[model samples]
Target: MTDVSKIFAPGGVLSQTIDGFQPRPAQQQMASAIAAMNDDAGVLVVEAETGTGKTFAYLAPALLAKTDDGERKKVIVSTGTKNLQEQLFHRDLPRIRDALAPDAIVALLKGRSNYLCIQRMDQFISQPIKHDPAVALQLQQQSRVVKYWANQTRSGDLGELTELAEDAIILPQITSTADNCLGRDCPAYADCYLVKARQEALEADVVVVNHHLFFADAVLKDTGFGELIPHADLVIFDEAHQVPDIASQYFSESISTRQLQDLAQDMRLLYGTELKDLRQLSTVADQLDKCGRDLRLQFARDPERGNWREQMRRAQVIEDSERLADTLDRAQAIAKAALGRNKVLDQCYERLVLLKARWQQLTNTQRSGYSFWYETTPRQLSVHQTPLSVAEKFTSYMLAQQMQWVFTSATLAVNGSFKHFTDRLGLGSAQTLVLPSPFDFAKQAMLFLPRYLPAASDPTMAASFAAIAKQLIAHNHGGTFLLFTSYRMLNQVAAILQEQESSDRLILVQGRTSKRELLDQFVDAGDAILLGTSSFWEGVDVRGDALRLVMIDKLPFAAPDDPLLQARIEDCRLRGQNPFQDVQIPQAVISLKQGAGRLIRDALDTGVLVVCDNRLVQKEYGQTFLASLPAMSRTRDIAQVTEFLSKD
Candidate 1:
């Protein structure tokens, strides 16, 4: 086998083939550790700090891994987001592959919904939409565009249609869900894009996917045509800090009004085409649809997530939910009556049974060790029964697979310890490593804890944050990221800055456009103040002069009232653990690390991180948060921050 160290050394294949490749001891160490683990089958949790070149470190070892018989080892690399998944598959993987093994086969597979279902699209085109005339016309035009693209697309991945809006109305109509997909029974089975992708993944030595799809497969084992992970010799999770929450989400059971609505719409479609003789199908389907919408109306119009146990205490909520259950029973009865008449209707019946069971489970607040919560959008409501901790479940699943597992992220350990992350996922026995970032942080960056800022909870906090931001933006002349823990604070500061900043300075806020577009605009403008919330905290990279200042509004703590957090707190209390120290502080520390990591992306990058919250200095637990961050020069003076920016 090729030496992993040689591949990452100064005079290595990577240095010779890849542009601007610099040798880093930490990167080589990480690659060597992973290569060593490839010979064994157990869990390894690594915290490869930002600028550690972790992607290449992990990729090199995986690309060269071999089985006992000298065959290439099968590996699955899962990322935290689709954007990173694409970046790895299309950009990073190819570079590593070319440098190490050009003949290696790799495949990128996303969730089933990302691929266009030809059967669903054909069904949609055959039927006329019953929406408002203007809306219907718009959807018709979008569908026409999709049809044209479908004819030309080989992958049928909707991401390839960059021209289409992410939230296009026609998307749900054309995509397939586990509940709606007919699988091998469909007319378009031979030309299915999802199946083709899975086939390629099955044959490839490396398969790249996102965390959501990975967990979906772990839970459902239905996302892939054949199970994808079980066949792999190794599995790696990047951005592994996100794994616990995402794994918990997949392990939970959820029932949504949109799902119920979709089932109704599908039944209605079947009634018009396949099972026209069943006149009662349309009535029950419409009733189910109305009940789902009526249940949604019982909740607040504003989008929010709340404890479902509390929600069910309301008489209107109970009454509406019971009505929904009754409607489901009627729909299931109708579906059962026409079971043998059509395969699609039979599938609908099976889906109805599962939905009914899930509804019952979600409504049962008596269940221990689970958090019952409901989230609402403008048009739908989804109730979930999430396990308080996925530690046992995840560990058992990992053990069952018996594959070499690696969990890595820039922000996994808290205060130089991996206990917080490892305990959450029950990887207590896993090997651990923490590699400091390759960048010289003390010289390249300054941590600014602005003095005399209002408390994070103060009503006037936004005003103080705006003042500090104004000062920093004036010093930096744009190229700033004012990251916030809450949208409320973000909007308030954005409003204040808009009124104060000069016309030539571009100010871009989140939610006005897609994250990708916002980032692209920020990079192109070279000097723009971008205000964003949680989404911009991490997985964002803007090296060089485009981003020289990052001001965090507050510590990125999970909201106290959040259902999952509340449940976890209660459970911790029962176990006689300090939820504040063990749970809240550690989670916040990791989050703060992620937010701070956005500043110094490269060794050549110099920046000032202005944390507007004074808690870092005033609170007793502040030292824990401080110890976890990079070794940067710290100050409480605004002048020092300005001076640092002036150097740029």
Candidate 2:
């Protein structure tokens, strides 16, 4: 076995090769612990706090592992987000591989949507323009840009095109979904980027993927095309705190009005180009499109997610669903009749059948052990049937795989117990490890709970939050993050601050640009205040003076109206447990920890975490939140907070 300690020790391989290297005891311990488990087939759950150098700790073992016969071991490292996935594959992995395992072959695999679909791009380029002249011209220009780049690109990963905006409309037109992809029948199948990426992953000794792709491929394995992720002897999950929710999403059965509409559009396109003689195809396609729209209209105008079981009880919902099913049956019949005429049509027929079955499954509320929920946008709606608990299914898969599993994250345990996470994932028997952050939190950070703040539920809370934010930003000069629980509150506070902006310090809002762009602007403009919601709370690292204050407007609690939370609460009650204590508090504690973790990211970093919620000090359950946080100096007086910030 390779000596991991030698690589992580003072003046070791990493230190000698990498600049600004400091030896951390916690990081070395974590690496050694993980290296010791590479020989066995058991689960290891680790809560390595911030600054633990967890990325290198896990990567070193996986890259250096060898089988009993002395062959290199295969490993899969899954991250919580695409950004992190790319970082690990493109930046971190190469550094570690060069230092220790220079021969290790590594690959990065993302979901199919991330890669450009050549067949779809060809179809999109050839399609006639039916939009307004100006709109058509814009699309034509965009298509030409994509065409030019497509010819020169090797990887065909859309992320390579940095000039294009993430929300570009041309992207959806060029990309293919599972329902629309022609698979082997596609003319571009031989050169398919997604296929090539998956093939590389299967051949590589190490593969990096995100949580969504891992679960998505797991679910797709039943369909026989889920070869995207190869079975590995060692599996490591970074940011594993996000696994339960992401796993639940994949395990659930869902059908969306957008998908139905897309099917109808595909049928119409086929009728226009391939099968001009199929008049019934166009008729049923139009009917299906109208039925989907009608069903969406039956829901409220404002976008929301609610209990699908309750919606099914309404007459209008039931009526529209029946009409949709009838239209789908008609479309399927037409598709079946023309199956032999076109491969795309045959695939469409199969999709119709699967979609109809999923629709039935989602509408059936009588099934126990599942939560039926529905969410709506301005023009689309999707229904889901999610299992209340993924523990049994997840556990069975882990046991059957017989691979050494490692789950590591900074925010997995709550109040020093892993029960909440372990129970949710059925990993109670797994060995657990918690390594405190190497940073001196007491000396580098302060927890400020402002006094006389409006309650989180009060209508004037946003105004009060804005007032406190103004004070903090004034003292800090603008290196501040005002995190909110909702967009409404964020916007309200943003408006109030905008009206009072008189300083040279810039104020950046979330929606004005992409997250990456916003962060860049905030960091570049050293004195800037950024107001954001959920996405800014975690997976954000701005060490040093760029970010010195993080003020959370409220405790990071799941909304009570959330259909999944409600379902879980009711299920807990039925099982004779305190849902508030068992489910809600733990979940909130994890979220709070994630939010607070934004502060003091490095040993030299210093910041003040100002949680505006008074409940942190006034309520009995507040102690749980406090205990889960880092051991920082506590203060309730605004004078202390301002004095601390002024010291910098």
Candidate 3:
């Protein structure tokens, strides 16, 4: 911090307002790592504790290197959630700039989904309406957000627009895509938000982007990473666990029917009242409509409403998606040759070709447990297929990178070893380090497992859950987070507690409200209980003792039904590896860490994380769960938990 202190000395490079926010030791180490990496390049893994000022550790280096004028260099920081992305862009990043270089330029970048494409919005608004209130609310909300965009938004990034529904159609409405962007020639080109945001990021010294977009830039669409990396000196990945997954997504292929429909809709909209393009576009749309109807007529149920694999009639649907994209690609060539220099026509043609190419890739690509499939309902549709084993490719990307690579999270190591995740990402011999949290976890938190609770297979798991919820929460009777892996289990837990015991206060479930709203209620609980899923796992913060008990129903394993997991596991087996040990357990360890992390959010936060699964004692893998967690004191006794809460 002496170096940081000098930087803040009288008329120092860093400004006066940020003088008080000196670098903590962890922050300095992070900064030092980035600085060293500017000239050096093995790999760095940082385990920054919560109060360790990790944000500043990386941000300061990105800022300092920019002091030299006109180099066109930057640092890319990727976080895991939109909330964290927002916090950094709107809060932390600005504070660091004020403390270090008040005049520095910065910007936040997100995926296309988070921005509004006014051209797309106009098309949706003009179309015939849907009757659902949520749908209506989403459309109306999109209009309001775009209205906000014209003035307060320069880049038109929706993260700048604070108020909107999570499911709003408006967000998807406004963002540009490879399918719809007319480049510099579209009617909305001057007003295009996505392009504008990217333009600004190209000029800014520090760019705050998410892992998805960062990896997408680095791999899938090489042009995106090219915009900054050619000039960038360093890159920081926060919530780095998500990096491997994001990298895999970009390096691999995905194509969907919904992708076709969206592009088709855009073409029709751009074509407008012109009867020729409409006739052509509508022909494609009608074909897709028939595909949906055929699948529905055969299955008699929407694939999305339940298990899609049960709908054996999808072979035709998959074939049709490929045929449609290919047919459109041919039509696009004719249109491009005939239309010649017309900007809108050229864009429509390019979009048609791109859509077709992606769809073709989806249909042809084959991997273990993978198939060309469509997820469809009368109202919703997505057509895509994904490969099971992306680990080989993910590891190659990491190993190939020339920059200093750091992967850190609260739970990277399972059972006192980082091998699980390291091996999964293909990091064979990379240097690894571990830092047990400085927090006296045993003194600040406790682990409670109900010995009497029935096993997952027991017919009375719900009843056992209610008894456990009552025991842990009834004593404190204020704030608690009941975490479950599934809506079925969450609903069961909700029913058990709501029907069997009376809290006489608000009990909010995940579906009833957004995760953000639920966390708010939990924080402000007069006697509030929040029931949430993995979305609530890591990003949540309920400080002090307001949040007292975090009851988990099962150790979160990848949903056994997920096509992605099924595909990956099969690929692992072909290589003669234990999928349970290599894939499932590591994935679950990260999730458990996220859920268990809900308890000790702040240094002062005092709560008990009750694992309803007694397997912590029964299963060998349970030891991994215990070791990955903060070093909290443990006990299976209910009496000890009750006694601990008595201090309140």
Candidate 4:
């Protein structure tokens, strides 16, 4: 019972229960550590590399832990992505439960938006949308699908509707957001799917969620309204490297053109049905729409995105935003006077209130440790203010909750140091552990650095990169992932390769198809080269020879001109810290590690990692990136790389 082998041994429950389950030393080590942890262990950061069976490492201990009453202790498992969350909830948890904790109850809790709101769907069905015929048609078709799922689905999660695209236009119409939910006042409150799901999560011994939902709930709890945090004694964060970024996003204030337009459109619907002669409100709503357009036109002149803090203080931007806020305030006054008692009108007014509040928060930037920025798309404009440091806030929030925290990821540490991750989360004194993947990288993998390729910043780099990719694909006969840092470079290199490569070899590029679809195609084709950007860098697992070669265009460094990156650099500079070393370098190292990890996923899996960036070998900081990766066989000779690929 003291060792994990009692459960993971050859004749143990796990081996007996799961098919082809060969236990690894890393998994046993991690499980032992987690089982030994108690509430007094402030937080634990574990860097379990690929193939470490990290999910079971945490889940096994969580399921095995019990209360005095013999009931399993509640554990909340939060992942960085919905895919991982679904896998944990639908696939992995069942196996673990059947083997160790059959009595353990499990529930999957997504955000409110993931559940269909019967009330909202009904309202949308009843409303006359005179705008786009295509949209109306899509809504009509998707509504029937939603209705069918509504009848059959116990969870009522939108994820169950696999036929619909993730970004389907009908989703928002049938789904409820925090701002739009009628709560207990809704007619369908009794059978509300979102509420029912939350109740299930509350009752379950284990709950699976994503980082966004976890932080949203944490923020809500800070405001005294969150429901799930109080019930769980242990919280496990998978893919925990994404926490700092996701936390910063949720903690910030943001107002977008779409929010304004949605509020206006909702007001129009309510005005037409519930109130009349509110011409002033209609005019103000029209003004709000115009203001949004004006702001986009004004900002879109420069780059598609930028930090508008200085420009936000300028006369034009400030005046326009104030005018938009004022219009909403006037609409609120008008709604109260005319459509005071109407429920639909009340909901519209509530949305307006939130819109106004968000606008105020975005414009008012007198507080310290906050950076303001704006992004402009062809159809939308947004203003955001994020804190320079979410570490203090995150640490306080976790400490106040008093739960045993576990943060595990394959990419948390850089150069064998957890300081970058810990400092970012203000968990400086927390316990940290690194469990390297049991896979023998040196024996199974090769790190190929081409000596003849152009520098990363050179104009001919794309052509050189494509040539290298073609050679690798030719040698390996597919199972290659050509990952780029940007879409522009991805498209450029992809086009170059497409023109030069044989027509028989399947080439799948991102953005041309859905990620799931692309992965399926890649696996089915077996000999296909996938050219993708940031999304394919991590959380993409293709065990066996289906994915063997991973080529990164350059170190995954954020664009210097990026608003958030720029702000972080400035923040570091202000603190008298070297931004390149303290911020950019560490971040890139983590990202590079994630990209490289895409190659060797399992013990038997073997591949070559080719970083096209000469800087990875030539720069002074290159050693840091090299040290951060698994100790694979390094080579500069093309002959060695081709020979290694020729083998298993």
**Per-prediction TM-score to the true structure, in the order listed:** 0.97, 0.97, 0.86, 0.95
Off by over 4 Å in 2: 38-40, 222-224
**Candidates sorted by TM-score, best first:** 1, 2, 4, 3
Give lDDT per model, in order: 0.88, 0.88, 0.67, 0.83
**Can you tell me which runs of candidate 3 are displaced by over 4 Å?**
1-31, 38-40, 65-73, 118-145, 148-152, 160-163, 170-172, 222-231, 267-272, 275-281, 292-337, 365-374, 391-401
TM-score of 3: 0.86
lDDT of 2: 0.88
Please provide, for model 2 over 170-268, each residue's C-alpha lDDT reduced to its tens digit, 9 standing for 90 to 100: 887889888888887889989999889889998999999999999987776523254579999999999999998899888888888889888888888
lDDT of 1: 0.88
Give the backbone clash total of model 4. 0
Model 4 C-alpha lDDT per residue in residues 173-199, reported as the tens digit of each score: 888767667777789989888778888
Q: How accurate is candidate 4 locally (lDDT)?
A: 0.83
Error of 1 at 196 (Å): 0.6
Of the two candidates 3 and 4, the one with more favorable lDDT, higher being better, is 4
